[model samples]
Target: MKRFTKFVFKALVGFLALSLGLVLLFKFVPVPVTATMVMDGNGITKNWESLSNIDRNMVRAVIAAEDGKFCSHDGFDREAIEKAIERNAQGGRIRGGSTISQQTAKNVFLWQGGGYFRKGLEAYFTVLIEQIWGKRRIMEVYLNVAETGIGTYGAEAGAQRYFNKSAASLTPTEAARMAAALPQPKERSVVNPGGWLRRHGNTIAARIGSVSRDGLDSCIYE
Candidate 1:
């Protein structure tokens, strides 16, 4: 029992150290690819863009569509989590309450899944990123790595692939449409929007102004 406990303790310490080191390393190094991006096979069509070059409209639209309280929250959104839990209990279509930060951590450092072990590691990485990367870096990394469409990765690639334009030139409506497809990028076509996507994009477009007006996205600027 004593020997087993010692082994477990050493393993835990080693895991923590390795995880922390990786997180720290990524803070300075641009992530070239993610597990999902690799798994997709056709290869990622990402042209990395700096935050300033990626258009503020795209930023606002994404924040409004995905996480309204991104600038203020730590690693989790408690209210959103609570609401997701309640809605999931009622149960028709399952809902997810993962914040942008959590998604970023998972996308950059881990694979996609809902396993307990994955969730636990996601939580750990989320905390590490929130502490080490800061809001601006987190948002930047997310914009640069998020799987925007099938074989598409990052704002630049998504913009070019869907609109034949650069990410820096994305209009508010265009950005909103892109943001709308984020939840199910593979199935939702941003270029040729369906009824649901049109409505959802409109909703996100409407909310974008409020996110900026209320300074809900000010952290990136700070």
Candidate 2:
């Protein structure tokens, strides 16, 4: 029992230390190998570029698709988590209850994997980033690091490759499609832009109004 306690303590300390270090590092340095996937008969990786209007609308689109309760919670939303648990208990696809904050944490800090250990780390990192970074910054990093295509890494890269423009130039319709491609990024043909992609994109675009981007101004102060 004592040994187990010691191991847990050490792990917690290590996690805190690593999260603090990453936050400091990100503030000062652009990551060396940040990537985005693109299509030109074939897909390829390219550097990620941060954008100016990685704004409320874009953030809203992501929240609409991923986590709509971002602004209300501190780091985790217990109610939603419980609801997901209930759904899974009744036989669902085992969807996560992660918020945008959590997803950003995974994209920027943790590796891509589907396992208990990785998810635990993702949760730890998510909580840390939310407490340290503001909501806007969290969304910014998410937009810049999230995998958009088979190999695409950020919105800027996705924009240039998919729409032939900068991230800031993304229209509401385009942003909604990009946001919708997130959950099925690899299988959904984001880079290749196939028929299913167009169809799914349109579906997400139709629900854009429900996302409530401007309504989140309240959480801005939090």
Candidate 3:
């Protein structure tokens, strides 16, 4: 039992050191690939862009559509998590309240899908990134690594694939459409969204202005 405990302690220390080194390395270096991209059966396409090159509208649209409190939250949003839990308890599709930070951590360091173990690792990495990467780096990594469509990853790739344009030049409508598709990119249509998706895209487009006006995206700019 003593030997087993000692081995566990050594393993835990090794994990912390490895994870911290990776986080610090990625702080400056653009991530080359992710487990999600690797595990994808569909061929992956991505182009890493500096946050400066990716249009501000794209950032605002995602903040509006995904997490309104992105700039304010520290890696986690308790209220959103609580609401998701309450909704899940009532029974239906499982909803998540992951912030851009948490999503960035998962995209960069972990895999897709959920389990208690994965969620715990996600929480651990989320804290590491929030401390090490800051809001701007977290947002940059999220936009660059997130799977945007079937066989597509990143804003640059998504913009080029869907609109034949650069991510830097995405219009509000285009950015919002992409943002709307992000939650379930393969299932949602960014090019010709209909029904709730179209409505959601429009709503996100409108809210992008609010995100800018209210300075909800100030942290990324800062």
Candidate 4:
């Protein structure tokens, strides 16, 4: 029993060291690929751009649509998680409460799916990224690596494919539409949005100004 315990302890230490080293390395390097990007099969269509090169409207829209408290949270949003749990208990459509930081960690380092093991690893990576990468770098990586559409990834590729424009040129409405499609990129079309998408996009657009005015997006700039 003592020998078995020693082996488990050593294995845990080795795993922690390797995961930390990889996360630290990625902080300085642009991630070239992710599990989801490869899973899509056609290969990633990413053109990694600096946060500045991606329009401010896009940033605001994403925050409004995804995580309103992104700038203030560490790696999780407790209230949103509670709400999601409560809603799911009612047996309606399932919902998610993952914050932007969690999503970024999963997108950049982990694969898709939900399980206790995967969620644990995602939480681990989320804490690592929030500590090592900071808010700006996290947002930059998220914008560049998120799967935006079928066979398309990143803000730049999504913009060009759906709007024939650059991410830097995306207007508020256009950005909101893009943000709206993020939850189900394969099903939602930003260029030719359905009525529900249009309404959701407009709702996000209305909140973008509040997100900025309330300084909920200041961390990225600061």
lDDT of model 1, residue 172:
88
The residue-level lDDT of candidate 4 at 133 comes to 93
Q: What is candidate 3's CA lDDT for residue 53?
A: 98
Regions of candidate 4 where Cα sits further than 4 Å from its true position = 1-3
Rank list by TM-score: 3, 4, 1, 2
Candidate 2 positional error at 119, Å: 2.5
Give lDDT: candidate 3, residue 71: 86
Residue by residue across 1-222, what tens digits does model 4's lDDT show?
A: 999999999999999999899889988888898899889877668798888999988999999999999999998999999999999999989898999999999998899999999999999999999999999999999999998999888999999998899999998899999999999998898887878888999999898899889998999876
Candidate 3 — worst ten consecutive residues by lDDT sum? Answer: 97-106
Q: How accurate is candidate 4 locally (lDDT)?
A: 0.92
lDDT of candidate 3 at residue 15, scale 0 to 100 = 98
- Candidate 1 colliding pairs, count: 0
Encode model 3's per-residue lDDT on 74-103: one tens digit a residue: 889999999999999999898998888888
Candidate numbers sorted by lDDT from highest down: 3, 4, 1, 2
Against the reference, the lDDT scores of all candidates come to 0.91, 0.70, 0.94, 0.92
Model 3 backbone overlap count: 0
Quote the positional error of residue 137 for candidate 3 in Å: 0.3
Instruction: Write down the RMSD of all candidates, one decimal each.
Output: 1.3, 4.6, 0.8, 1.3
Local accuracy of candidate 1 as per-residue lDDT tens digits, 1-222: 999999999999999999899889988888888999889877768888888889888999999999998998898999999999999999799898999999999999899878889988888899999999999889999999998998899999999999999999888899999999998989998988979889999999898889889998899865
Worst 10 residues of 4 by lDDT: 37-46
